[model samples]
Target: MVRYYGIFFQEDGQWSVRFPDAPSVNTCGETVDEAIEMAIDALSAMMVLGRKGREYGDPRGYEEIQAEAKDGELVFPVMPAEKAMEAYRPKKRINVMIPVDLLDRVGEFLKNRKGLDRSKFICNAVESHLQQNVEAH
Candidate 1:
């Protein structure tokens, strides 16, 4: 196992830092990096706090944090906007070819003839055919 430090940032931009297995945690930094730096700076304060009959709680014991950090991955368990955007990106287009007789039949069904293009008509026919046949099975 790798032994180093743990770090986290608060909503108000304060940093909390601690060793992997230490009771005395430190609160440091203004920005995240600064806060993390401060967190280590405040490590001495953690030891002082312990001397004054206080304790820093183990944060990972909380079920929510443990669940989120499962499998070495951060699972936020919340469907926020960033996650949704990553999930909904567009798919690549694909091309397909079919028989001449089927393509000709789609062409024959047009009313205002010139504006009705071959590809659009064939796509509609293929979609209809797939829907009907797929549901039958």
Candidate 2:
């Protein structure tokens, strides 16, 4: 339900969008409509990534953003879909106890798998086990 303020500018027939609140977030498209769509995507992605670094800026009021708009710039308010936000929900950390031998086996298995880590391996294993159990039932 959070809202962000953005400015859209058209140049040479292409449209570009930028968030005043978040200087690091911006996108462009062939048309104004397309630019708005891309802006939503970029905003949603930044929202997810920002949670990790905790550095995303806060949105300004409508009047404030509109007043700052320059010539040929259109001020727009964007609200990211709740579903999109939930889809990129942050991971939760939890502690687990495992036997020493199994821990060693996990480490050895990960050593052979490039770009795979203990967290991903464990998550996949647990999901697979749950799927099998559900299917059996």
Candidate 3:
């Protein structure tokens, strides 16, 4: 888990939140608690994008942020929970062709591995093969 610093403040009677590390992320709420919850949601969304290989700016130091903070502004840290990460991993279905013998072997192997499923096993195998070939080049 990674912790990110956020700036929370009230503006026009509404609480707003922004992450210095990721300026693109901003959220607002009717109350401080609500603002924090919204900030968590925003952070989770950003983490999902990062997991999908999106780039973000580096975080600002807490001291620097403290120096720059306006009156009534507060700094808080937020981290994406495991449930958030799991929720972000969306799965897709695809069709592939393979030999009947290979399919049978895979099925047998999966049956032996209690929690492993066919799609996950195949995906892992393909990813491993691709990585090996890429490294060989």
- RMSD per prediction, one decimal? 18.5, 8.3, 6.3
lDDT of each residue in 1-137, candidate 2, tens digit only: 68998899987789998887888888999988988888888888777767455566568799988988899899888888665665566799998999999999999999989867998789889999999999999
- TM for candidate 1 is 0.27
lDDT of 1 by residue, 1-137 (tens): 11224435354545444343344443545666665445444443443334255553533433545443334322111111332333333435677676888766765767568755765566567789999999999
lDDT of 3 at 3: 76
lDDT of 3 at 45: 76
Residue 27 CA displacement from its true place in model 2, Å: 0.2
Flag the better candidate by TM-score, 1 or 2.
2
Return the lDDT, model 2, position 45.
77
Clashes of each: 5, 0, 0
Error at 48, model 1, angstroms = 6.5
Instruction: Return whichever of 1 and 2 wins on lDDT.
Output: 2
lDDT over C-alpha atoms for residue 25 of model 3:
81
lDDT of each: 0.46, 0.84, 0.80
